[model samples]
Target chain A: MAFLSGLSAFPITPSDRGGHVDTAALKRLVTRLCTAGVDSIGLLGSTGTYMYLSREERRRALSVAIDETGASIPVVVGVGALRTDEAVRLAQDAKASGAAAGLLAAVSYAPLTEDEVFEHFSTVARESGLPIVIYDNPGTTHFRFTANLVERLAHVPGIVAIKNPTEKPEEISSHLAQQRSMTPKGFPIGYSGDWSAAEAMICGADTWYSVLAGILPDVCLRMVRAAQNGDVEEARRLDATLSPIWDLFKQFSSLRTVYTIADLLGVSKAEPPRPILPLPALAKEKVAHCLTLLEQDLA
Target chain B: MAFLSGLSAFPITPSDRGGHVDTAALKRLVTRLCTAGVDSIGLLGSTGTYMYLSREERRRALSVAIDETGASIPVVVGVGALRTDEAVRLAQDAKASGAAAGLLAAVSYAPLTEDEVFEHFSTVARESGLPIVIYDNPGTTHFRFTANLVERLAHVPGIVAIKNPTEKPEEISSHLAQQRSMTPKGFPIGYSGDWSAAEAMICGADTWYSVLAGILPDVCLRMVRAAQNGDVEEARRLDATLSPIWDLFKQFSSLRTVYTIADLLGVSKAEPPRPILPLPALAKEKVAHCLTLLEQDLA
Candidate 1:
């Protein structure tokens, strides 16, 4: 895996009733993703409940993911922070802990000034031993990174790839087109939206970061392959069938919905973390319908 | 004094660059509050960066507030939780640790189901000795707490007051109308809206929580007294004088604005914790201007 450019199944972590990280269930998830032969193990991404975990838990989870994969797959630990010092510390920690790479979010709690984001990433990149990927998970108001900010970050010390989940496809594509030098120079932009992966790829996104891949890695990986092989027909077919499940991720909380999907697939363990309330009975049934559809598709 | 009629100032905590709680600064804050004689010492509320603090930091803060005040005033601690169990634990911890009462928010991070909210508060109230108030700091979410929900919650165990900070003035008044019957005979239905404390009090709010009070308690307490004395005209006059100071609190990050206000008033020795990022120079100047307004009012 040359710096992880395929289907990255960011495994959803199962939590205990006590809200501690369920390492036992996490082990089960790694085994499943390993069995499914996911391109790279991305732990502590947004879907992985990265922000919710305490520092010790985050460190332990990243270690677990890396140790479980056993160098067979690259492990990219998510290392986003609101403070520059904190992000840099995490980056340093991630590199020292043997992570293959670190994926950092654009901004956190307080909105970053143009120079702050650049300085923040530049420090992290300079300090970390491994390659760094920028994460644009601006679902919350805390971090709203504009295209200009990305450009400022593009030249930061060691940024290698980016996972952009912005709503605008044309804008992303246009931005990439303007910075045509970035991709071949090895800065691949990945698309994170499950609903728009195919379209994003069509719009110059070279990689795919799948939250849906947490439950159905094979299906999503196949869809990505089909799209790349210029099999738009095959890709669209899979997307249409998977749209229901994909919609559910955003309908409820992503952490909760993904955990439910994992439970339905019987791949991960029961229960999600605190702050993320569980699926109501009706939501569980709705999720089950999507699972059944995927089951039928597999059958 | 009977049920704290209007404008409870949620003093912003001072933290060092490393994010440790500024205890010396905290003592100064308490002394000022005691001297000012606000209805209550509303510690650890949202304006206090409750969400950003650790458990130890939270407990230490509550201890500091109570110790400085002695028996002179009541100290209300914000013991909200992201998890029901954590909320219960914090409530018990707060009660044992000497918070006069707990002014808990619905929860952190996740939106609450009406049932979950009831269960959360009831469990905390049942387990803890402290009188618990239900705080609806729903600026935390896209979700708003409805009057019907509050009405339903009135029957839940241990709910004393309703702390609402909504743009909608009617929400708390509506809850008060229901709470008049549901609350156990005595207590208040308080509303907090930064600078609009006089207005919220005029509309039947028994408590107004102020951030500016953490810095210049005398100015805020006098305004509260003016409002309580059936002097809306005088209160409005105070409101006109304090408007500039209030404007500063509104314009910047709550944590930063409050901390700067604390610094200007010569209260806390601490700054915002490491990860909160830094306030801009312009924001610092605005806070200084806010302090100048306070000085003018006091003079």
Candidate 2:
């Protein structure tokens, strides 16, 4: 549970166009997160293209990540799939492979009811026995988790935490407080939208399930650490300096932008799976310019 | 292209919990569509739980449907998948199995761009050599096809038709006209939402890609025939008679409601794939009552 609270860096699962995992490249990314001392490693998350990869590829990515972390950093694997049975198998794979927990999203194509989603979460938790972190990513899954649903799922045994989509900066406090009041005491509430995550953390969020942290953990760590240490000004300053990057993320989605970032920084040159083309050259150039400006501003 | 017109019956691909295709049940459903004289069979569609089934199961379903139809009715199989390569492969499977065409939706996890979708559709059509129908079911795929995008895709070779979600009764005429004007001449534009499809057909849309017709093809065919024969009074009257069923579809999605109808009518007893639980007892009772009312009215 403690591992669920802090900068849980969500790294992409590098793969070829066929969705075969690049284990060597994945291990490199995990090692970078470990080396930078991210509080936990969020492996195979949305940013990891978890929904796009095959079960074998997902397992391969997790194995490489778990091997790289080596008990030093807790690794939470994304176990979402369109089928309940498939999700259970993925969670079981994560559990048997030594993952810390399984992040389960209500990945739907049928536009499920609340009761269906409840049963899905309960069944996955019961069957897999892997602790669950409710992954509320409406942008991809298209199923938004109500605060009421989150509160209900919180009480389900083996369901430990939630990764909420962050609200705007002005609403983070009330959103965090309402979630706190609704759920059990000590239930970790994390936020993901990278642009607003720092404010969420500063407003006392438990974790930042970050895409930005996946590629550039060092700066993310500094901001998270500053927030954790109660240095509000320092955290805000770091966030302000990274505004250009956030703008790029907002404009061209974090997943696409991060892929470009990983390539630009010589971390990994893997293109996202097809149907999600690499950022066009113009967008890549814009991302590159942001990185240069970020380096100068941080310096 | 002619096969894409008139009443297209979309039957559920009955499958067990493990995602194995219930080939017998599925063949029975396809046989029913053919016997009812539907123009085409929309196999493995959203109502068919296409996204929930595995690749092997999808292939099995398509094979069974194609075999059952036996060149009598064109089978437009759903070939949608999250990845482009996988979609292309599914389209290839459909083509190899003698499916008439592939139904491709912009099934997304990364929340694709218009360009990405354009590329996805173009690639699937070009690579598979199977005629493609743009399955624009935004309710499930969460990717809306802009009129402009549809206009663009219409010109792509081998991309033949579109199955659009119906608009409100008052808007159906203009909506149909707008789509007709935007796309190239002779591009088939069909409507799917069952309640509104009668109105769309009367408004001169090319097809009614119907879920209700999958089970009760006779009633739907009568309506389509009435609209085609310029009997507006008869078509509207038939639409009014089926209003109860439409109410149920609106409340509990066409997919879930149709599953219960399939079971209640003894066409298929297979439950939908898991994570999409069957309707609760009360909903089932309501469906049964509606069927009783429908039988008396039709008689």
Candidate 3:
């Protein structure tokens, strides 16, 4: 929970053409993010393609990231699974691998109840024996965690923070206000849905759980810093630079577009996990243009 | 594929308190459905809580249902998994256990592409050696199979039929129209969203892959028979009788409400898989009232 603020870069799991983890590329990506001074490295995030990899592959990916980053930054490993037992096992593995915390998302193939969702995190929290970050990504999981549910999870032991999606700005603002009013100060709420990160930060989000940071840590850091410093105009300006990539993400998923960006940047050579392909021709051309503009701006 | 038409009853998996599949209850359910002359029995379906159970349990459940039904009717096993390899393995196991066909759903924990989905099913089709029925339940899978994707899958060898969700009647009608225009007559399309079965059937759907049929096969068969005999008025009347339970399904998932209905009927003692709890107290009261009205009408 110590590095629970600022920018947490979620890196893609670089993989070979055979879909095996490309450890060398993964190490390079992690090292680059750490060198760029990202506050933390989130392994196995949606961008990490955690769901596509096997359990052993995912555990290995976590260890490789943690070992490469060393003590320079915290490592938050995504331990989400469709089943509670599988999630608990992954969380335990993250703890054994020296991850700073386990990010848990309740991914369900069946419709889940409020009590069931609460029980899922509570069980993972107790069994993993590591600080847990509740990942409320409804887009991928198709299960929304309402503010009321978040408040209930806040009281569960070991659940120390949250990575909330920022689809609805007004809803995010109202929920953050209600959560802030709750006792014990509530868990620190961070924002994903990178396109809306600036608005969420401006609305008092504690951290930016970002996909953009994974590929372009420096610019993402600058945006987060501007928001943290209350430099609203500067934050908006920095955020505008992410617009081209955001446009592609809106059309497709960030899960697909980010892999293309990483591949284009030569920071990593990852094929987005199978079943999810690399960007199509037009999308790739658009991404290349976006990267060119980003490079010139950074220069 | 002989049993591809009429009512294919998807039984709620009867599970013990510890969540293990209750084989005796499963057998009872299968015997009841088979005796009632339902066209086929679908095991390990969304209603069967396939994702909630582990691989071994799923295989065991399939075997029990197959054994109980004993070729009196075909058994279509839901062989959905997050990984293609896992799905193939399940499909093979279903074949080895004497299941008539494998229901292949592209259930991804990650976002997938059209080509990726095509490959997932095509690979399973070639490898499993079982007749494959593509299960297109986008509500659970989070990945929609466009008519384009379905056309692609229809060309895959061993892919014989489709169990399509009927959430949007217009969309289903449009897609079916587009699909019917393609050569080889394509695969037979079945409807799953029970509340809309009559509409789908009237729209030229080949079968009703029904959850309600698993518990109340006589009533379900009556509806399907009416549809089959071109008794649209009778079909509408029968479908209207399902409205009360359908109301519960719209509120929660059919997976949960059907379990409550089955429990109330004493046909089987079952709970929906973990993370998806059985209906709460108020919902249970509502289901009981609906069942009483239904029972009185049947009498």
Summarize candidate 1's per-residue lDDT along A1-299 as a digit string, tens digits.
34677777788766676657778778888887888888887788877766556667788787777778887878888887655566777888788888878998764433445556676677778866557887877564245666677776776667787777745644666765755554446667677878877666556567788877866788888787887788888888888888787688668855678888777767666665554567888999999887887779867
> In candidate 2, how many Å is residue B10 off?
0.5
Off by over 4 Å in 2: none
Q: Name the DockQ score for candidate 3.
A: 0.53
Chain B alone, TM-score of each model? 0.89, 0.98, 0.95
Tell me each candidate's TM-score. Answer: 0.88, 0.99, 0.89
Clash totals in order: 11, 0, 0
DockQ of each candidate relative to the true complex: 0.26, 0.92, 0.53
On TM-score, who's better, 1 or 2? 2
lDDT for model 3 comes to 0.83
DockQ of 2: 0.92
Give the least accurate 10-residue stretch of model 1 chain B, judged by summed lDDT: B107-116
Better-scoring candidate (DockQ), 2 or 3:
2
Summarize candidate 3's per-residue lDDT along B84-182 as a digit string, tens digits.
Answer: 777888999998999989998888876677888998898888989999998998888888888778877887789998888775766778766766765
DockQ leader: 2
Ranking by TM-score: 2, 3, 1
